[model samples]
Target: MSSSGLVQIDGLSPIRKEDRKTSKVMLLFPPEWVPTAPYLALPALTSVLREAGHTVVQRDINIEMYDHFFTMEFLIWVKGRLGMQLKPLQDKEKAGRLTEQEAAQKAVLEEAYAVDVFDLAQRSEDAKLIVRGERFYDAEKLERALNTFREAMQYISAAYYPASLVFYPMESNLGYRPGVSKEVFACLDDEQVNVYRDICNQLVLPSVSKEKPTVIGISIGTQMQLMAGLTFCKMIKESFPDIHVVVGGNVVTRLQEEWAKHERFFTEVFDAAILYEGEHALLWYIEAVNGQRPMESVPNLMYHASGAVQQSKEVYTEKTAALPLPDFEGLPLDHYFVPERIIPYLATRGCYWGRCTFCDHGQGYFDQYRGMTAQHVVEQVTALRDKYQCRHFLFSDESYPPALFKKVSQLLVDRNVGIKWTTLIRFEETLQDQAVWDLAAKAGCCTLYYGMESANERVLNLMDKHAKKSVIQNNLHQAAKAGIWNHVMAFYGFPGETRDEALETRQFVIENQPVIHSVELFYFVAYRHTPMVRNPDKFGITIHKQEEYDLPLDYYYTLNEPVGISCLDAMQLCEEFYKNDFSPWAVRVNSREHVFLYISKFGTNKLPQIYAATKDGATTAEGVSGLVTWPMAIGEGDEGKEGMSRVVSHGVG
Candidate 1:
């Protein structure tokens, strides 16, 4: 870095002077989600191309769209849409078509419009202030600000647009389920209500026009991004027909088989769809586009040709493990949602334990497990800290390699890396090691998310988790005692799961309220391509599909054999249980912003106290599944030591 503290990448070997003269590749991450942190895929891909002597320009339109849309000026545009909805009621009242009760409700809504909700146009400066951290951290103020924001967004969604406009839990008509191209194409044609199209014109087109890149890659990681991404492709193809539009990510990988059936969709929208670990596929696809290689040589790429989808041969390479460290040089780091920029680094690809029946993770392109060496991870961390002046990281892995992270923790401790990081992990026996947990905490591990899945041992075994109820508890206890926050992810509505078993899972969470800082209870999603979906009979369920072509969509209907809990019943029960019984600190599932804010304010150790006070106000457990024996204090004390020792000594077999 220069003396100005600006990031300087001129010395990097990957960025050669001649590469700037080569074809310019623009990688874009679309908008309408949490503005915190650029998704790691773009940076990882950028590194791959730059290392191969390619000029790449990476831009995050997600943050840019947030900056443009979350202004007071935009409030006036929203109010106009809300007014259009209210105009019908006014006309009805003018024509005497409203009854007394209906008039009263109409008047109430008018009053809301006449009040400060409509005055948001004047609060534009305050909106900026609130988002800029004047009111972001304070729970009460943040709630009010978000309520106002949500009210405006919901009104816009109801009045003009057709998308779930929220900071988290995004959904849209352009759904992520496979074979939704026809439906999404209809959305693309809706110019009147399609705010996404407007966004692309306002934000995406200008940049593309300026750079004039030969290849444009869009990363769609979730169902929420599907609509925006497809619209982006459509708009780009319509305006700049020659730019090769490539779309890929985890979601595309999931939909590859079904998407191939709709060849016209690609013919109209994108040039190709790259699958799996997209680094190799994208590089080869770019090369093929540049005439450096034949189209047939490109691996893992699918495109339309001769009115049919043409697919390249599947490529296998350990390139992800050996690729240059992800380059975040061009992203707008300071504009992310969080106070500290959390760079996502991948330590492994695919799951270390890939036996979960309901999971499609580590399948297809990611079937083989690969992990970067511990020394490589250490070097990457040191380089990132020095280059970006960043101290927070979120490890982007299916499940961080347990043995790999152990070595990383030791290296970070020895080198005094001083970087706070978090990642998802399974309930493995290594977590029961007190020394391991302590070393992780010393190396700045703040939170460890465990996929508890279910509290019932039968349900867990049925899912092939290979973890017992007792082991989950012990790991949580040891992690907490070692000064790391424990986030438990509980899922219900599994095949053949009884109502009693679901309730038992809820009860287990209620009992372990002290050591557990947060819980994310989820209803089971029967993803396609998983063992459970492929062979429902093996799990004692019947999948009733309309067609027999093995195409997977997000939602499915199934008959539970011998009267197991239905998905609806499970969802309703979980909703009621969480609303009535779960601790207030335990946020609703997928509320990423709330989790970050909670940790940012209280710190990880105090999370149990924060949540425990909400329900019965107990920081210590009274017989918590034989896992935690005592309450853990922030500093090293006798109680904390005893709790750690007990957890370590009773490690689950």
Candidate 2:
């Protein structure tokens, strides 16, 4: 074994021509651009490999693809395309084929013409510089730049392809929405919608080739990334036929049975699939791949054997305290879309509650909740802060373990890590304590995203969320009292939920608007592996059509019979309710990027004040207490349209 404890082996005396020999390996995060903030999976795996004394290279191709696509040169190309493809608003006959979204892009194109192309280009450049921290943050300038960036993406998608690439997440038509094998393969085979293939080929493949790794590991964390992950696997197998390919992530962990039954998928795309947490799995698998042992010995692995699929004993569970600080060896931290870099760390894995019926977050091997010691957490942060010269951080745990977080919060003060962070947590009774909230705030807790799924007690019970509506209200009150921004994630349309219950959720948001700074409302999605899906009858839901399109495995169900409201009805209800005021909508929080700018100018406690001044133009020191303004989206009709505004119920100082 090597000094770092990684197993090492010698090649055969003469190394057979067929036995490709190299210890180098590359870990990849495939694209489907979401937040430019680093995802935690690759870094976690990288830490494992490096601690085991292996040569590992990690890359975030998702952010890289965005950086490559959003360039001045590409903007020039988009400008030229817009000149030809966009029709005047008066050309009704020619514009008839345009969808609502496309027509909106046409309006953006027309607006672009009002300003000189060169001037628009200058603004675009300034936005890039501002995003990269080259210019000062002006609220108006930031708003204008974001609008210009959005329009640029809209123009490209509308004129050239069928995709949505914007400031937030990137969406493409080739998503693995149809979880079945056939639909996924069809989308992968279609080059028109699969623009990521070209992106991988032009930008990623060259870099991978240069690394010359013997094995390629791809993380497929969400259904959105399935196609891109498979595309990379297919490309690598075709180009470097001798290279070994491995796939794993949250999505892979859930679809083990689906992959096993459809063995041909793995045969054609990857060599093996890591079942659960990958730290130990990758370490053992790499040793086996190095010819030190046989593949059958690797735990929690699914691979092909003699024309049939085979699985190894499932026995790898990571001890969080044992994990080394993640090594971001080859990742381009500076290239992420934001000016200030935010490092992602998972302080724990699996949900502590582990029983939300609408969630599959704790199914199968993921049910066991675990967390690192508070000391370890602080040490990891300090090391990362020193190494990256970045003090911004985010905990990517399923739900940041509350008890662990409280301990770490105290440690942060003693150690003085000097970092600002955000994390997701449940609205449990433990956090209602002001002492806990104060510890978090003193440690620089900027935001806490609570799973305030619903305000209706019945809906909460049906979903097995186990959180009482009143308790949630108190938790938000305490969090806000600590001066931390409280963001609530809500959802309606759970099985058997009535319209009255849905309305109650909205009313709850309005009543607690003082405590809750932002709200993200989503309709319920019945995941296939959830307890509710397993016993749909209990929830009075019937699975009518499991497969909606040729997409990855997403659920489609209807209440067995209407219980006061249907899914469609619930959706419309929420939409109409929030139509006039969007402040409660999470869209206004701006935490993804602008929140950092806000804090830099105004102290953490004064975020609401800056928000009021910028968003509402309030003259008083207290700022506006009722309505907030949003820059009108292109083609949104009028300047002060109700649909284009967000309203905050309380003033912040």
Candidate 3:
């Protein structure tokens, strides 16, 4: 080992900086993310790595897993696996020693066995064709295709009993809680319930073997992907002991401190982890591996060295303008569920308005805000548009700053980029101008998702989101008038918010239904890194922490004086709103990508065909009780509707 504690190969010799060896890299995007578009992380990191003379292959394993799940070959394999599981369970039951869990597994296996895998496989294959071709424009056929995917997921879920895997809003669970590190580690090695192990064996291992990459990086952006990402990492490490494995992304950044404490993760799972902005850090890490520099010189890195986990002394943030345009050359763009490819673009590094007490998205960045100029954004976006032959774009920024939003809108119109796009934004008084909305629409702004946490002025101010009610209403009205679909995201129970204040938010959404195209209502969560959680007493709430949940990102809480809505009250209110008042927002096509395509095709947000059909087969504009569609129906748990698409707006400012 070198003095910096990096492992060195026997035969390879260290080269000078000017003659740096080309590192072979395999970048994997793990499962449980939306399969509509390629995530920006892989491409973003790939561009930087390739720019530094590295050979990089980026794989969207999430989309690939979904694609493989719908194939006849995979479905038949799942049937065999299920049968093998059922055989052992049957023997145990016949011997009169079956446990309740085993019996339940047997039941699931039997039901799945009865599912005629041949017929389902054919339908599933047909579903793939429907989504990729012009047939996707037909709403009925599209809905059937989506249902076919869900059915395939159910069939696959049976092989891993107790694991509920779904297609679009990726709410898969492996019967193991992710917040508990013990459960996470146990789930990694679980043969029966961890579907990702099979996924890693079938999909990931083959690619790694063929490429023989010296370094592999897995991006775990959300909690949903943590298990799968780690599964791939652990499997890759075990199978190819020589290849270096590293994990990064927003979720990894949030859990860096927790990971430092878990030496096993560093020693057994991955060789290292890149935190915060990973472009420069990963490049330097690859250099360290190649022996061009010491490992200790790589910024934002945490690695096991000399019997301990050592973090780099320095931190680095990307200069937004200096970065190259994201390269999507190797991704399977045609295989996404949508017919036309929607490229994800990021114009900013972090949120400009980073004062929301309930938000922890800012934790993902070291330097809170670093953005590209309007001209730079337009240049890169247009370049990507022409290169990919894709017209639809998803601006994947935490929140587009108002000045940049206005300037980019003007530039796109003046430059005639002609690409339909959508992004997450905060309702601001600066965006109240009708002319600005018109310009944005003319520049191909198909949709705008707003994080309108609450319409009650007091609650909004308390959340540190001082958006005025009038300004929010005006922004919605103007955006709607400009033919842009407005998706309003609000929640109940922010610390001391009273029942009437929560109702005021509901009333605002109901009263503004004409302008509010769609809605996602949720209950409050005191994320571990949020301002409220960091200083709970100041917010008049007490956070409850349990020792078992060592890797928790959020916590359960209670109001100190009970003067406001309790956690249960917020959840119940959310459930009641969806039960009684979600009809207007409930659409036949619930995916944001699907809605974006519809709006782009029809040139308007008033998509009557996309709304939920009445019993008589006609679409209705009036509110109807108990009429819920694919994802608008809130679940019974705290993981209420996170939105239609995870890629579009999960952690938006």
Candidate 4:
């Protein structure tokens, strides 16, 4: 019977047909958020569900959908559809060079982000300049991000969530995305809608026969989709009224604090909405609906049944330490777009240093921090390697707990998990020790994402990111010495940022070129749930009155600082840096404008944007550093957003 029926997928293997004979459940990944891939989300949900003894199935609509979109024939058609925008990418070698006609258009697109018009730090007062007209958008670069992403998808092959994909589908937050191009919009949208409809049909009507699911648990993952959640619930109800539809995820919790009382506002949609984590709430509700319980008293569940919506009490305030690891046994690990199975994990919840003004890291009403024991960490990886037979894992932490990491990493080395992993890490107390590094690398952690924001101290003081440049630099250096591939995340356009500081940032990149993977940029955007959302008026940051959307929305307003520049001015600076102004430029002195060239490459899908990791006189290397920059754009007449953390290089220029 070794290959006969199904297998139980606990921490290592999920519950497959071999293990369960009665029930079936499917975890649906709505499209658009490539960043929040299904690999990260599925494990968390499934682990908890399995803990409750339920059989689970995962349907990654994004991958299945993309397979239907980007084909070998389609890339060329998309490039042609994008026309001028894609001309630069056809030949990677000629990325930066432009024809006069193309140059003129590029100039216009580059200039669109040239003026810091929001008046942060009074730059607009000193210089009356505002980027306008054709200069308002970087159509070509935007096109590059899209087409490259379309092309990159051929390479990345990630499992994505459709909720946001159905809505904003583009990675608009960071430098990682294909810039938003208007030309690709029409064709992509048509394809996206077509894909969504197709998948929904597949869900309702699989080609072969299967039992109707006992319950449908729809996740409202992002807060931006409150209305979409309503509409989605209504649609599901209309389609699958025979089955119970239970709603969950962080989105519902946030809504409860604001609009759960407005049940009349969302009638025929959600049968029950869990405000907090879905573990216990889901188990009780499922059984109650199964007629096993006479009357349901499920904690943290909301329902608009019997004509009125009823609210429930909070479940667990603190996260449990002995968390069940994601069961990946029957799940499609190979389906993800990675070199190998990068099994992503979570070590903790809520950032340790949570005082940053603009960030909502510690905003979950129950934002209590809980990390797993080192023993548990080792056990899970050991089990995964024993069962799934994989070597790579990725940690999906906002900022993974350093202590937990220290112990867990050490334990992995001792236990010989025989796996390698990567994580999103922070500076400060975490990066100070050497044991953590030695243990981490040996334990299979080969990469670290360090958010090093700025090289300037004044900026650091303003941002309140206690991460000192010296400490980060040394840690990044040491990590490299230990043979860890490091990624440093940085940013531009703060409240008090000067072209001089930007130059210094580029200089830092040049100096520290050897011990990094690549420099990344994050435009400061005010996130919801933080203190900034509490009083944007006090901060001069006009808050965005959020509107209902089918996807994620930037609700917090972001402009420039108080003294010299406007938000638009800072935005202009960002545009320039994004276009021509390059970081890690000092290393490749000859290729100083490679960033601009890289932009063109993306536009043309010709050359790859090169990152400088190590420097050799005239050349720069490639990799990541530990640079993390918080935003300063709140709004004009604003004090600016949180200047959290931005790490720069020490000696390149």
Best by lDDT: 3
User: In candidate 2, which residue ranges exceed 4 Å CA deviation?
Assistant: 1-22, 75-123, 134-136, 158-160, 175-180, 364-367, 545-552, 583-593, 605-653
- Winner on TM-score between 1 and 4 is 1
Comparison by TM-score, 1 against 3, better one: 3
Per-residue CA lDDT of model 1 for 339-371, tens digit only, reads 566677776766678777877644333446677
Would you list the clashing residue pairs of candidate 1? none
Candidate 2 per-residue C-alpha lDDT over 1-653 given as tens digits, one digit per residue, 9 for 90 to 100: 32323232221122343553337779888876354477777888888777666688888888777665566675565566556655544375385766676667567656654545565566666666766674435555554555666655564554434445444433355534446678677766666457667777877789888989988899876656788899898888888888899998766876776787887777888999987677778777887888866888777688888998888754466777777887776788887656687777766666677777766655324337777788888888898999989888866666677788899999999888878887777788777789999889889887776667789888788767778887898888888888887766676677788888988988898888778776556566666667777889988988655433423334677888767577677667656655544543333224343564455335554453334343455322121222122221110100011011011100000
lDDT tens digits by residue: candidate 3, 180-282 = 9999999999998899999999999999999999899998877888999999999999999999999988788888889988999998899999887788788
Alpha carbon lDDT of each predicted model: 0.65, 0.66, 0.83, 0.47
Which model is ahead, 2 or 3, in terms of lDDT? 3
Report the poorest 10 consecutive residues by lDDT, candidate 1: 644-653
**Tens digits of lDDT, candidate 4, 1-653:** 11312121111122343543334565554443332124345556667667767777655554444443433343333333334443453343277556665555444323322322232213211111111122112333333333333333322111111112321132222111111122212222333222333444544336112646777666655422233334444556667676666676554554464445455434555567765555545656665675554223555667765667766543443244655666665555554432244455555665555555555534333545556677876777677667777665555555666777788777887776667666666766556677668777777666666656667766655556667778878888777776676666565544456667756765676588677644555555655555655766645566656343212223636542465344566566655654443444322211111222222223321122233333443322222211211122321100011222111100000
- Which candidate wins on TM-score? 3
Candidate number that wins on TM-score, 1 or 2: 1
lDDT of 1 at 251: 62
lDDT for position 176 in model 2: 40
Candidate 1 to truth, TM: 0.83
The estimated TM-scores of all candidates read 0.83, 0.82, 0.93, 0.66
